[model samples]
Target: MKRVALVGMPNTGKSTLFNRLTGGTARVANWPGLTVELASSRILLGANMVQVFDLPGIYDLTGGAEDEQVAQRFLSEAKLDAVLLILNACQLERQLALALQLKALGAPLLIALNMVDEAKRAGITVDVAALSEALNAPVQLISAKYGQGMAECKALLTGIFSNESHQIDFSNIPSASTLHQTEKQLFQRSVHQPPILNQSATDKLDRFVLHPWLGFPLFVLMMLALFQLTYTLGTPLQDYLEAGLTWFKDGLLVPATANLPQFWQGLIVSGLFDGVTTVLTFAPIIFLFFCLMAVIEDSGYFARAAFMMDGLMSRLGLDGRGFVMLMMGFGCNVPAIMGTRVIRDHKARLLTMLTIPFSLCSARLQIFLFLSGALFSPTQAPWVVLSLYLASILIAMLTALLFKSKFKSSEPFALELPPYRLPLLSHIWRRGWGEARDFLRLATTMIVLGVVLVWLLTNYPTQQHSYAELISNLLAPVLSPIGIESTLSIALIFGFVAKEVVLGALSVITGHEGQALATQLAHTLDPVSAYSFMLFSLIYIPCVSAIAAIKKESKSNLYTAFSMAWSLGLAWMVSFIFYQSARLFGF
Candidate 1:
C-alpha cells in the first residue's frame, strides 16, 4: 500500500490543494493533545492508486505549537512512501520552514509552489530548478485556485509513483532548531522587497475604525447596522423561499399523496419532501449571511476589527486571534473550529472553542429576529438584538476570566494589518458558495430529520392528549419559575440541536395550541421572560455537528462532556437569573 502525505503552513492553500487532489471529502479533525482542529482528506494517486494523506496546516514542525506537534507526530509515525510539501510562493520564507523539517524525516519529498498566480501578480520570480536543488527535492509550481500548472505537478507526482524509488533528503533539517541550515540560507537569500507599507491609507481609516474612544462605539454601531440590513434584506429572500415551499407542498405533495397508500404517502409527503423542504426554506437567510461575511473577510476590515478589539480581549485575558474565530462563528461554527488552529496556546485555544457557541450565530440570529419581533415593540427591536450581542460578549469575558484564573495566560497577540484590498466579487461569490454548501451539507441534512422526528413525538399522543401537552406539563414545573410553563420552552430545549428548528418547533407548538396560546404565553411571561429565553439560547450546546467537532477536536471524552455540561449549566443559570430577577424587579 503506497502511502503519501501532504503538509504545509497555514493559509498556504494546503486545503485548496487537498480539495483539488482528494476531490473534496475533507473533514475537520483535532490534534491528540490540543483542542485545536485541522482539516484532512485522502487522495488517490496514479496507476498504482496509492493513498495520500492531507495533514493539518502548521507553520513549522517544531512541536512548539499544538498543530505543529501534530504534523511532527504524524510524520514520524506514518511510514509514508512520499511526502508533498506545499509552499506559498509569495510567503516563501515562512512556508519553507515546515517543508525543510518534513524533509529531514528521511522521506522522498516534493515541493509544490502554490499561489504562483498571486506570486506573478505581485512581481515575484522563482527558479523551480534552483529551489529543487536548494531543498534537494522535485519542485513544481501550481495554483490550486486558478488551476495553473496543476496538471504538470500531478504528472510529476505520477512519475514519482511509477519509479517508486526516489532519494530521500535530510540535509535541510536540523535537530537543534527544528529547521535545516540550508532552509535558513535559502530564505535569507530569497530577495523579495519588503511588504508594502500602506501607512497613509491606514492612518486615514483608523480615524474611524480604530479611534481609541470611537472604536468600540463604532463597532457597536456597525453591528447594529448589519443586523438591520441583514433582516431588511434577508427577510424578503426568506419570504420567497417560504412561498416556494408552500407551493411545493400544496401542488406536489398534495397531488402525490392523493392516490398513494398511507405508508407510501407518509414516506413521500412527510419523511422525504416535508423534512427536506422545511430545512431548505431557510437557505435564503443563510445565503445572505454567507455573502455578507465573505465581503467583510475579503475587504481586510475583518482583521482590522480584531485589531480594534485587542485591548478588550487582553483585558479579559484572551488574545485578539480569538476574535477572528468569533467573527467566523457568526457565519458558521465549522470554519470557526478550523480557525482556532491559528491560536498557538493550547489552553487558550480550548477556552475559545468552549465559548464560541455562546456567541449568537447567524442560525440563532434568524430565530431571534422572528421571536423578538413577535414579542417586542418596534422601538425595542434593535435593543433586543443589541442586548443579545452584548450578552454574548459579556459571557465570553466571564468565560475568559474563569479560564485565565484557572490557567496561565497565553502569549499576547500581534496582528499585522495588511493593506486593504477591494472585494473581488468572484472570490467573494466562491467563498460564499463554500459556506452555503457547508450549511446545507453539514447542518440541514441532519436538522430536517431532527425537526420531523420532533414533530412526530410532539404531535402524537399516548394517553389522554398529545405528547406536546404532557411534555409541556412535565417541563412546566421546572419552567414555572421562569414563566414559560408551556411548549415554547420545550421547543427551545430541542433547539439546542440547531437553531433553525426553533421556529419550526414553535410553529408546531403554537399551531397545536392555537393563537390563544400566544396570548396566554404573552400574559404569563412578560418581555423579560421572552428575553431570558432568548439569552438561554445564546449559550447552549450547539448542533450535533458542532458537538461531533468538539469530540474530534478535544479527542478526549472528558473535555467534550465537560464542554457540554458547562455550557448547559451556565445557560440555565443565566436564564434563571434573568427571569427570576426580572420578576423580582416587577418588570
Candidate 2:
C-alpha cells in the first residue's frame, strides 16, 4: 500500500478532492481550521491499494501557526509515496508560493489545480501544459466538487507511484525572496486574468450581508430563524422516532422481559431502555440542527459571519478566527476546543477554549428543548430556546471580557471569504448523519450508565428516603436559593457526565419517560424555577469529554482546573440572579 497526503492552502477544496478519491466525508467545511486534524482513508487505485491523508490547510510551510506547524512537521518527517498539492485555480498566484516551497523540498509532488469550474465562471483560465512544463511536475486541472477530470487525475496518481522512486531534501528549502520571485514568474507564464475583471456575485451579496449597519442584525436574525426552523420542522420527525422507539421497547422489549424478576424488569425497562430511548428521541432535532449549520458553512456564509464579528471579537481579546471556533462549539465543544489550534496566539487560543464550553451544544440543546417545550407553550418554546442561545453568546462574551486583560492577544487577524455556492446535498447529509451517530453512541454509553446510577440511587435501600434523597438533602441548602429542589439537584449532579444524561436521569428518578417525564417535571416546578434551572444547566460545567479536551489542548492542569472552577461559579451566580430577580418582579 502507498501513502499520499493532500496539501493545500485554506479552502482550496482538498477535503472535497479526498472525498472524491476515497469515498469519505472528510468533514467538508468551507471555514478554515475545521479540518484541524489529519483525515485519512484507504482505497484501491487500479491494482494498488492507496492511503490518502487530508492534512490541515497551511499558508506557508515554515509558518508558526499551529496548522502550519502540523503540516510542516508531517511533511518533513512522514514517509510518503507522493504529495498531492491542491491549489484553487482562481487564486493560483497567491497559492503558488506553498507549491514552490514543496517543490524545493524535492518531495514527490503532483500539482492539482482544483476548482477550475469556479475559475472559468469567474473569467479566469489556467494553462495546464504551461504550468506542468514550467515546474517539470504532473499537473491536473480538476473540479473536485463536480468530479470533473477525476479519471485523468487518478491515472496521473498511478503514474507517479509506479516509479516507486522518491526522496525529500529538507536542506534545499527556498528562502522567501527566492520563492516570491519564482511564484511571480510561474503565474505570468501559466495564469491569465481578464482585461476587465468583473465583481463576483459574492461581492454584491456581501454589500448587504456584510454591511456595517446590517451585518450584526442579520446574524442575529439568521440565528433566530435557524432555531425556529429546526424546532418547527424537527419536532415532528423527533416525535415519530420517539414513537417508534417507544413501540420497540413497550411492544417488544416489555413482553420479552415479562418473565424476569421485578427488580430485573425495572432495571432493564425503566432504567436502561427508557433512558437510552429518551435521548434517542431528540436525535432528529440535533441532526437537523447540524444539517442547517452545514448548509451555512458549506455555502460560505459562516466565514462571512466570522469576518463580520471580527471587530467585536477584537474588543473581547480575540479576532475573527476565535469567533469561528466559538461558532464551531455550537455543534460540539470538544472539537471546537481542539479547533482553537487555528488561533496562532497562545493566550487567544486558551481564552477561546475557555469560552467554547459555554456554547449551547447539541447535547444541551436537547435538554433545553425538552424542558422548555414541556413548561412553555408551543409558541413560547422556540423563544425560550432562542433566548438561551442569546444568553450563551452573552455569557461567552462576558467570559472573554473578564479574561481579556490576563490573556491579551496582539496577533493580527485576517480571514479570506470563500465565494458562496449552493451547498452540496451529499456533504450536508454526511455531516448530519455523522452527528446523529455520535449522539446515539453517547446515548448508549454515558447516558445508560447515568440512568442506571440514578435508578440505583433512587430505588436502592428502599424507595422512600433512598440514597439519592440523602445526597440531595445535603445539597438542598445550597440549591434552594436558586429554586433547585432535591430531585432536580440529583439530575444536575449526574449531568456532569454528559448533558444528554440529564433527561435520562430525570426519567429514571421520576419513573417516567417522554411526555410523562415532561408532565412530571411540569408539576414539580413553576415556570420561573424551570427557566432558572435551564439557565443553570446552560451555564454549568461542560461534559467530561470537553474537560479532557481542554486539559489535553492547554496541557495545563492549572488552566483546566480554573476553567472548571470559573464556569461552576458563574453558573451559580447567573442562575441565582435570574431566579431571585424573577421572584422579585412578582412573576
List model 1 lDDT by residue over 1-587, tens digit each.
Answer: 67677777655666657767766634221111112344444456555666766666666655466666667677766666677888878777656766666556556777899877767766677777767777778889898756788888887777665345444343455653545466667776653534673345556887888888888888788778766766678667766876777787788777968888864675455544554554565566676666666666655666777888888887776777777777767766755765676677777777788777777787787667765655777567767988898888778778877876654565768665644545545555656566567668844565666656656665565323767677778878766665554667657767767776665565444432212334544665568877877877788778766777777766778888888898888887888888888878988
- What TM-score does candidate 2 get on C-alpha atoms? 0.97
> What tens-digit string does per-residue lDDT give for candidate 2 at 1-587?
89899999889999999999999877788877777889999999988888899998898776787877888788877788899999999998788988888877777889999988898988888888989887778999999988998999999988888446355666667765668888999999899989777988888999999999999888888888888899899989988887888788888999999999999999999988877777888988888989998898898988999999899989999888878887888888898998888888999999999899999988899889998889999889988988998899889989999999999889999888999988888889999999999888988788888999988898888889799989988988888889988678888988888888999988888888888888998999888999989999998999999999999999999999999999999999998999999999998
TM-score, each model?
0.80, 0.97
TM-score of 1: 0.80
RMSD of 1: 5.0
- lDDT for 334 in candidate 1 is 56
Please state every model's RMSD to the true fold in angstroms.
5.0, 1.4
